[model samples]
Target chain A: MLSEEDRRKGAELLLQAERERKPIPQLSKTFPDIEIEDAYRIQDYWAQARIAAGARVAGHKIGLTSRAMQLASKMTEPDYGRILDDAFYNDGARIPASRFIKPRLEVELAFIMGEDLAGPGVRIYDVLRATEFVVPALEVIDYRTEVPRAITDTIADNAAFGSIVVGGRPVRPFDVDLRWVGATLSQNGIIEETGVSAGIMGHPAAGIAWLVNKLHVVGTGLEKGQIVLAGSFTRPVDITAGDIIQVDYGPLGAIGVSFI
Target chain B: MALDWKTLEAFAEHLENAELERRAITKITDDCPDLSWEEAYAIQDCIRARKVARGVRITGLKMGLTSLAKMTQMGVEDPIHGFITDYGMVPDGGEIAMDALIHPKVEAEVGFVLKRPLSGPGVDIDMVLAATDRIVPAVEVIDSRYRDFRFDLKSVIADNTSAARYVVGSSTTPFAASDLHRLNVVLEKNGSVVAEGVGATVLGHPAASVAMLANMLGRKGEGWEVPAEALILTGGITEAVPVARGDWIDVRYKDFGSVSLHFV
Candidate 1:
């Protein structure tokens, strides 16, 4: 556990890293006893600060939901992060490379909820019923901390969420089988990764259900009109300036973004 | 505001040519910025006339974006309708020529063969079921005539909701024989399951999509009714799965048999 003072300091460090687009040393290194709860507290402090500064929380993002992702990250469970309004982009957006440090991209499906969802036992059926549509999206992940970072450090850094680019055809949740939704990611016209949404813990909505239940533990829930990015299915692909990233979601359509 | 018949015809021809050539053009709305919904439907009617003049028979109609998910994804608030031509038919377990489509994607649907003509300003689910003679498994191949499949409602309506080709299953069942809302559908590509959905995926009940279609047509004007013996594809039950040449697509409809097609 971290002292409240230590948590505040960690929040400041993350904020500074984001503001300067520079990576900072891991928080776990400084506070060896920092617990997952402490890390969440630090994240909450940072999120509150941002919200107070006029950045609204648009929705939540669940990360590390897939077993493959969990194994790759050496984490046992998924983590949640806030998606701020300023970090959202549309398809074909040209984003400045300098906005993030050591960014990577992952293809995902975003759910736009039509009704508020809170849960102690929110199931996939509830998510399906509440979802207005599902659209293809690309998550820009930026590790604000230096390497050798622990899970606590990552959790405090808002699960490495930087921004998101959503595009492609939206389909009603029931219109298509969400589990079989496939995404093919390409950079500079070369295919880099391919995967199906079922990788997100058997089904993409399963992750949303997990998130809702997790949030309900803290008396919060997914709100209507919010965009929730279910965890990514494909492995993260490194990105750089001048890179053109496109994700083809088959019948769901396609979305592309360029970094400059 | 209303558009002149000449302008609507020109737009219709532009879209018809794109469809015939299997080429994509920019959305029609880019040229006709102020095109209204009525004008868009007029243009669509004009396209249908041209096809009929060329000996193509209108076999049925289809609903697109009928589900809330589809509407949200397309950024549209309402569902759209389009015509299905006899030339668009691909037999079950048959092949679809890849060269005849721009970029095609297949979606599983429930096909309704009507026995009684149905029109609506107030059509409901019961009325739709009463008029439907049989419900069969179906797969619709949608290929937008707009470059990149990007278009607004007006543009998509003018392009016939990207309707390309479709295959209906051989077996037919009474609409009341099964629970339409709970029927499961699994779509496979190359022997692997690529998509799965339920009959409820099409606006709660597939019949609801047909009802909405009838109502939309009634609202359009007089003398517009889904004719008897017409086959109506109750929109896509699952998201359209992309296909390529040599790919085999199969859709399994629970209790209703299956539909298969190959892209050649």
Candidate 2:
């Protein structure tokens, strides 16, 4: 575990890197003794600084829910990150590519909760019942630090979050089978990736159930009216300036954005 | 012809769900064309009972569709009533999240804070003024759960007169019927005055709506009456104007001061 000073330095480095639109060396290299708890503390410190500076905690994002990734990392639990309102954008938004450093996009489902969800034994049914609706979304994940990054580095960097763009048809949690919902990611008129909602830990809301339980250990819980992004179903597609990204969820509708 | 108790419960459930989910659904009247006004009020009561059971405090009641223009436009003779909740209270000059509402519109209104509990079968404007406390400027944010804001009187009544949120001004004035007479009403959006009218447009006197509300309640099942110390919103004075994200709304009541809101 790193010392308090070390965690503060790590958080400052990540925040400065993001502010300057620059990527720093992985924190794991800077603090070889960094622990997962330290990473989260550093992330917390980073979030506190931002919130103190006027950024709001809009919601949360869950990542590393894929079985293959979990097996590769030998982790049994999914990781979480706080979503800042500063990074929120609506569908068909014209985003300036200059705002991010080497940004990439992921296809995911976003659950907007209607009620507070607490942990310890929160079930999938509870998540569904609490969720107001599900909508198609695009998560732009950008690295604030260099690659060859360890879990500590990623966690401290807010799960590599950049921003999120949400649009398309919103359906009630029980309006249709969530697992069967599918979408295709298109970039510059080419279909790059396609995925089913089930790819997110067998069901998109299952990760939220995990998130709520995990938060309970820390005396925290998912707040009412907060958005929760289920982990990506498709691989992150590289994005650059002047790229047009469109994600089609078939009958549910499509979300389109411009990178300029 | 009254519907079964189970049907009322189901309608209440759907209406509440649409509100909580912030999604619009077809009007209930579309499915049941013969749905009576009394049945609509029953469904509304069921919705109110559900809210009360959940511990959501009913702060005040609102009178809607009372303006002569609104009544003529909707072809209605009487104003409809609905209750507001504590969760729906927006502070003066506060921001409202657009995502929390389906499609919101703002109405310039006056809120009557009662000094004493008054009930009536023959409540008149003089009686309403006699029991009054102070009057405050208010902007009622009406958001209908019906798709495209298309709903009959009966449908809207069951949907709580499309009440989503409300803002009460920090300033207040003592009750006087003459003070409300011919007062200039203005609604500004994004720094531009878009709507204007006279305060008397709300059925000659704003207090008249409260009397109407009290009388209507007196005619309801078992004669329901409004309790004392309640803050009641009179019907809209000017036309209700549509609002959206990034829109700054400022409603000025000639002498009652102004209530402003920023949408985000």
All candidates: interface RMSD? 11.6, 26.1
Clashes of each: 6, 1
lDDT of 2 by residue, B166-195 (tens): 999886544355456345566778765455
Candidates' DockQ values? 0.04, 0.01
Instruction: For each candidate, give the TM-score of chain B.
Output: 0.95, 0.95
Those runs of model 1 whose alpha carbons end farther than 4 Å from true positions after fitting are: A1-260, B70-77, B171-178
Runs with alpha carbons beyond 4 Å of true place in candidate 2: A1-260, B72-75, B172-177
C-alpha TM-score for every candidate: 0.56, 0.50
- Per model, kept true contacts as a fraction are 0.00, 0.00
For model 1, residues B55-117, the per-residue Cα lDDT tens digits are 999999999887664466567666999999998998999989999999999999988888998
Q: List the residue pairs that clash in candidate 2.
A: B117-B228
Quote the RMSD, in angstroms, for model 1: 14.6
Q: Can you write out model 2's per-residue Cα lDDT over A75-140, one digit (the tens) per residue?
A: 777899999999989999999988988799998999999999998899999999999989888999
- Worst lDDT window (10 residues) for model 2 chain A? A190-199
Fnat computed for model 2: 0.00
Best by DockQ: 1
Query: What does candidate 2 score on TM?
Result: 0.50
